[model samples]
Target: MTGDTMRGAARAVLVGPWSARTWQACAHLLAGFPLGLLTCFTVVLLGGVTTGLLVTFAPALVTLAALLWCVRGYTALQRDRFATLLGVVIDPPAHCREEPGRVRRLLAEAAEPGTWRQFCYHLLAGPLGVVGFVVTTVLWTVSTMCALVSCYAWALPADSAFGRHLHTPSMVIELTVGGLLVFHLAPFVTVGLAAADTWLARTLLGPTDIDRLRSQLVSVTQSRNAVLAAADAERSRIERDLHDGTQQRLTALAINLGIARQTLPDLSGPAREVIEQAHEETKQVIAELRGFVRGLHPAVLSDRGLDAALSGVVARSPVRVRLSVDVSERPSPTVESVAYFVVSEALTNISKHAEVGAAEVTVARNGATLRLVIADAGRGGADEGGGTGLRGLTHRVASVGGSFRCDSPVGGGTTIEVELPCES
Candidate 1:
């Protein structure tokens, strides 16, 4: 439709008949003749037999399934044919293979619109192929003969009807001009036919709009999961680096400072004051670093599992937490991590704004769900909108196909509940 494209196409049309693309189109049409005819036979013959056999219970179902699968396979070959001959690739529709039972899978596949679309395409191909093959072949044969009449005309008997029809120089000139015109026009015709076939192939063979959207959704979900997993892994790695490298070095510095203070007893008063201050600051810094690294990702969680990990968390909380973990089996690492963060964040919130000194935390696994409940009898009206840090916990829970709820009424205690997929 663009001016530049129109001009380019006009140019191609004027001098494009001898190009390889034109010949490829011709060959494609010729090859499709046989392929399309075979498909037509498959639809008419196999389909009719399957329909008649429908009254018979088991045999009919089996035959129908086989027919559908054969049609699918045959459609794949047609797709490859066009791809190979005309350099056009048409992808097949997406088919879910998740059904566990054989008969159920067959029923599901049969119910899919993709199967019927392909069958319809098979019905139309034979007629389309016949037209393309006949038209292209006729143009090629007749045009070539007319263009070369001057060379082959001498071989015709002068007295024969065919020779007499084109014996004149004017006729030869006219026929040759017509032949040249037809030769130039043949590419457009073949291209037009091939374009029709391309449209049909894509419409029937390619995934439907719903299927395409579903595939996109699946891809986005997978990408989100990957990003979440990568982030968790990176956090764990940083935690390890801080614990093994930076924390160890800081601890050594604190120990050295402590040793320096006690080992030399003959230092000046000003010097001793500076050393004591430095030693105190170093110890404080070391304590903060240990908490920071533990908060990043706990090593004990990975070693002793969720129950012991939650116990450690409770031991460190400023607000006393009555902890109960009923999970007989540990959930996945991602789910466990989410559960830990949820409880930790809730407890931190209670410590900061709850005006209460005690809370109850429960972690339990019921079937495929890992559930966590954190309850406090503090002054209420607590929610994510109040900047209680529950929003991040909600997102974290959802990232693993889990749920989070905050139930905090005015004058009623806050109860935070979370559920995570154990498999995830």
Candidate 2:
């Protein structure tokens, strides 16, 4: 073997004998014993009382509710202990929303499956704890006594039970060897027991699989909403900066150029022609900037609401658009913005891909939902997975708890529909 390989082996042997994890596992096992026994006694007592009171229906219901509540608290304490000692953290299930009355809320909590799972865990923990505690205590005690046998060997009389067979040299060798083996093996045994306890706690005390999935779904939904909200805020900020800062300065420059063009001498030559061209170019730039600002987020959308904003969209479409709005009250700005983009993109696609001259755009509010439908009398074969713009619009609608759908048959008309919740 190489010199490096020998040194590495020596280091491994030294490190293996002094791992902190071994002590932690031993401590965890020791703590579980008392906790498990206490939990077991409490669960049994409460369960028995609750069952016995079942003869009186109302009392039984009340007692059972209280017992379940205690079990939840106990499980939470155990979960914390497991995290502190073993570094295993399990997520608890979401609490049920409270109903109107106190009794209803209590009953709701009692009906949860997690509450019963906790009870089951407490029921089984007592025996497991006893077994772990006994095995760990016996192993450590025997190992320590054997390791120190040399110190006490001379004190015992020759006729005594242990002294009769004790040959100091041979006894020391045997006891020392046994002690070394047990000392090294104890950590593995304790760790195994700790792993078992952790498994039981996670299986019964932690959230169920369905609950975990539901939690993940809720988290995803919230994150999506946050992203959409941030994007919308950023768009609004950019639009404001352009309109209030850049657009204003551009408008002032165009006005100044026009004034300079008219005030310059009527030379009727190259110099006069240059001034007029500069003025016209400035005017053209101002118009393009206006269009860009509108595309970012139209001021009309904020000032006049979806009705007028969508009217602007229809007016700008290359093809003629039949438009209608039936909203009794204005929806939120976010809903209106998404609706406008949906229409704008749809019309853009229609003018580019659809071989028709005109399309219909409809917007309506029914109860708490805002509905938008854009239909075109053109040859249609729109596919969401075919890398069409409709797929992006679908995601946009879904980001705000909305649904998007498209129906288009080859050589037939295409229809795109979206429904957004506009609850105030």
Candidate 3:
């Protein structure tokens, strides 16, 4: 092969994706093993503290917290290392979001059951890491020592520490066989331990269901805020549309009608009667526009309260909707409006989609949650993403730390359930 061709082939073998990953993984395992073992040991000694007496338990507790912090940092490092080197994913515990008081939060987090379990694994991993490190280190050292037999005339006839232990007839013969075997096998052992370390890290450190759900709650809370912001935006857009379009047109129409009324005395012709007819039509337009704006967001939803507003909604539904509410006390405006909207939209869907003859809405305060149930005898199959309206309502409910559930079975009926945290 040409020199260039040979060099290219060499580079390809050295820098291939999996090849580079394998090389780095083997190197990290060899290095991290010692560190992992030391971390484990420190964790164990620190865990035995029962009291803090400044020089005694105090230092132990502080050391314990510091060791756990180091382990947490190491866990992050390993995640990056493993993902890059092995194309595998590993994650650390999520205790970072608990508010300002770091020491208190850390202590609370450490007190959790899983923390102790992970601490045990961290301790165990350190010893395993150390053992693997020493084995690989000794293998390489012994093989190098054996390789130098050719330079030293000290055929030393099985007189070296390792040679005498092997009990071979001659040191040169033993060195030749042992060096070749150790040189090849040492790397494989290190690789095997590296694989083991990855497995241990994943199995021990991955989040449990409770941990996952807790994290999910954090996400849910953030999403709830976004939903609220979107709702506010939608409300603003609707208000602007009404004010600029329908409201402006209604105001202009009213002004034109008033002018026509004053000018009617001068004209007693067909034009006068036509102007009067147009003036009456303008009054109807103004009334309809006012009603439309009220329906979009009623001031009553805030003034007379959710119960009265909801009762008004039930009264207006085409289908007979029986309202049963025991919410004597009021909740937060967001909670009440969301609850009201959920019921209103759900009933609207039932009337339009459910094809039900009758519906029932029950709202009651149960402890910290305001429970709402809207059931109808309509064709079922109701889901959060049922349609644009239902989806919007779902977003509205979620904005206030509330959940929406719709159950509709085909040819059966539909039921919408929602629970919102109620705090006045």
Top TM-score model: 1
For model 3 the local lDDT of residue 8 reads 83
Residue 92, candidate 3: alpha-carbon lDDT = 66
**lDDT (Cα atoms) of all candidates against the true structure:** 0.86, 0.83, 0.71
lDDT tens per residue, model 3, 93-157: 65644646867676776676656656666777677767766876787678767766666634445
User: Residue 189 lDDT in model 2?
Assistant: 81
> Model 2, residue 77: displacement in angstroms?
2.4
On a 0 to 100 scale, what is the lDDT of residue 177 in model 3? 69
Could you list the CA RMSD of all candidates, in the order they appear? 4.7, 5.4, 7.3
Tens digit of per-residue lDDT, candidate 2, span 1-424: 9999999776654464367776677777888789889889988988899889979989888788778777877888888888888788978856676788878887787777877788899888788878888988988888777777788877755454655556457867788778767766776787788888888888888888888898888898778767776777788888899989988887888788778777876667898888788778888887888777777678888888888988988888899999999989887777878888898889989998888999999999999999999999899998888766988899878878899999999889899999998852
Residue 168 local lDDT, model 1 = 73
Residue 310 lDDT, candidate 1, scale 0-100:
86
TM-score of 3: 0.65
Q: Rank the candidates by TM-score, best first.
A: 1, 2, 3
